[model samples]
Target: MENEWKIDASESDVLIKSRRSLIDYMSGSKNNFKGHIAIQNNEVENASIEFSLKVNDKDSNSDLKLIDFFENDETPVIQFKSTSFQKVNKSINFLKGNLTIQNITKVVELDAEFIGYRDYNGTKNASFEIIGNINPKDFGLYYNSYSSHNGYAVGSDIKLIANLEFKNQ
Candidate 1:
């Protein structure tokens, strides 16, 4: 049987940082996501990856502004599924996937890196980092406003970074 890996959601962290050049400027992040990855030959092998985030679970250490960023009542969940994986090296890789937001799915690419493995407590674990950028407008999460300081209320790109750990369970 092939080995399967699962994300240690309790120990892993997914932080999504978004920025806006509004009149006063705005930037924040949300940490909390569930993800999994398939491994082969000590590297990511195929497209058996999945990630999900609950809109209502977003936190920015201030007000709950993410709720309005997403239509939680209609699309409570944001999802991502891998379509393919390309290994660049032992430490670097690329994942082509689909990200679904508010029922809209768009093709996206994420840069991944294997940060090596470790023995935490009594269990073996693997660590990785994934980074990507997306245009919120592509997912129907557009915030348009003519900024007096600049051009638009928010930039077209939103950056997402996740430092994930998988337990050999």
Candidate 2:
């Protein structure tokens, strides 16, 4: 899809926005996410896809965050239950709850959503980012090395990778 589209960053952006936090001790809230898509023949409509997310992380927070985002559509979408549904209303509710993580250090897949064709610039390249809040309870470290919040994230170190493809029809 080549429409000069850009994923406008939001305080609620679904992806992580800072890599410094992954290691910086002074880092505050954190976010981590990943995605991939492919188009063949023409393009897959967001209304007709059933995307699947496979998230992994050494920190328990990452796993929990991924789960939070994987919410089902409350309202009926199209004539089925898939991520590719073009119904915007059917998706708004679900997208809002997209998961979140805390103190993630290990590598893991974030998510995969089915989608209808939406003109993705031109080719389905692996595009990605991460930004959001992360809890400290999951991490083995604490603020100022304090004992009260020892369960927070430890040695922050995060990475993200996105992948997409275009196949000839």
lDDT of 2 by residue, 1-169 (tens): 5222222112112233123322221111222212222332333223111112233223534312322222342321111112322223421212112222332342222333323333345644323222223343333322432233344443343332222222222
Candidate 1 lDDT by residue in tens digits, 110-132 = 99887768989989888888789
Relative to the true structure, candidate 2 reaches a TM of: 0.23
Give the Cα lDDT of each candidate.
0.65, 0.27
Give the Å shift of residue 98 in candidate 2: 6.4
Models 1 onward score TM values of: 0.73, 0.23
Please report how far candidate 2 places residue 151 from its true position, in Å: 18
